[model samples]
Target: MPDNATRVLILGHGAMGRAFETLLSARHDVAVWDRDLVTGVETQPLEAAARGREVVMFALPSNPHDELAARLAPCLATNALCVSIAKGLDARGRTPAQVFAQHFGPRRDWAFLYGPMLARELQAGRPGFAMAASLRPSAGARLQALFAGTALHLDCLDDVHGAAWAAILKNVYVPLIGAADGLALGDNLRGFLVAEATRELAGIVEAMGGRADTAYTLAGLGDLVTTATSASSHHRRLGADLATGDATQLAASGANIRSEGVHTVAMVRAHALFAWERFALFALVCDFLDDPARLQAGLDAYLARRFAAPTGR
Candidate 1:
């Protein structure tokens, strides 16, 4: 390690964790620990690994964030920054920021990294982009230092809540693109959905106490395009499966498929997070998930409503 290397601990050794390790290990002293250990790698206990670390990254899904945050809170260094890349909501409909704030409070330094960061591309040493938002003003600079000399690039922003919601909401919209492609609706519809999704996303983010423009940032529009079109994206594949009437795959347990959007749909609806009537596109997605048989008609009706003329004129 370089003389100026920072100590970093990455929680969760999944693909994203390993990708981050690959990105940062060359310049930083890095340690990784997962709940389940791989066969041939040496690892340390979570608490031990966290001590003295300047940055601790949670690369796991949002569902496990609560437990992990609670466990690692006491072990983290006083000024250490906690970064979460989770792009979904927890069972309680809380974003990663909500979970972190619950455990770390305002005093602790924490940040959210969100964007079009595909693990496969990052692992392959291809360039990736993300936005870093944190309560601490310097958190972005700290993250930039941590990943210096790597292909991953970071843009700093102050709208942490907006960025987080943008990231989460993008995943929810990706399925619509996949479903359109799966139905052979062509590129015209795909383009339309992308435009409408971005608009609706801005409104929803604003309503959720985030800046509307943040929806156009890397965390929202950038990530949405990547996840929507990527062949390897789980949510995209879920939409395709839904289009093909693959009930077996659609009904598979979350453990088997790991589609965050599916769980997001449930959480949003259950919590009544937004005014559903205002977001017709999102509401249509929720309706599709509830009854896949209505997809074709739903799309037709949605398009009709969009193209409908001014009433009574």
Candidate 2:
């Protein structure tokens, strides 16, 4: 509508996609696409949505990324910026960036949006910050500039791999805090979970050829805190349900709900991208997830070995 407005094509009709449309439509020419006929916003055919848009924002989960990316590759305007909000690994253990790169190649500019952003809070106009990671040094700053007047404050990151991995791994770790909460382990253990999870995340990130320190940034630590502590967080609630060992309770939480962390645990275990055993805290969570009966014994063994390992030997 406005002369300076950038054309934005949003994929998916989910909450995150709708939120982005709600926030940016008034200012920018926005079009949304979904497989089904969606309400609340006008839906466009895939080709029409991708045509001439300056930026294509994917609001779907990671599972659909590769397919949708392949479909949209030929439709996208040359050099259009592609943004991913998915925070988990695909079936091939590929990050969103990797999926898009495989499909879009050098035809599109790529960026990942990650941090403590909940679509509901964002739609309600709550102030929030996120990291925009890109391999191109100017991509982050350019993205930051795009939201210059918005409530969403964005910081750019050059370590795209580090930021992406940090964001992904935080989801895997957040549920541990929730399980601790379900067990009523108190703030003391909560503090330990935070410290140990961050440390383990850094090690995994480094092993995967990413900057280990990125784990301390907003994409990693900031998001971990939000997902771990928030009562509204599905992953947190899932953890609490897991701790109770009630299959019906877990089932009642809904099969359709996207718990990125659940899939991430399996991916980490299957991929062997890192020395997963070295990160005892992460391994503890994985072992517990794989066999809930091991929650108590696994935790005890982890703590015992951690404390008893002789220092300065």
The model with the greatest lDDT is: 1
Q: Best candidate per TM-score, number?
A: 1
lDDT of 2: 0.81
Cα lDDT, all candidates: 0.87, 0.81
Q: How many residue pairs clash in each candidate?
A: 0, 0
lDDT of 2 by residue, 154-227 (tens): 98887888888999889887777888888897899888889889988988888888898889888999999888
User: Which TM-score value belongs to model 2?
Assistant: 0.92
TM-score of each: 0.95, 0.92
lDDT of 1 by residue, 201-300 (tens): 9999999999999999999999999988888988887887888788565677572225788788788888998886679999899888888779899999
**RMSD each, Å:** 2.3, 2.8
Candidate 2 residue pairs in backbone clash? none
After superposition, the stretches of candidate 2 with alpha carbons farther than 4 Å from their true spots are 37-43, 249-257, 309-313
Those runs of model 1 whose alpha carbons end farther than 4 Å from true positions after fitting are 37-44, 253-257
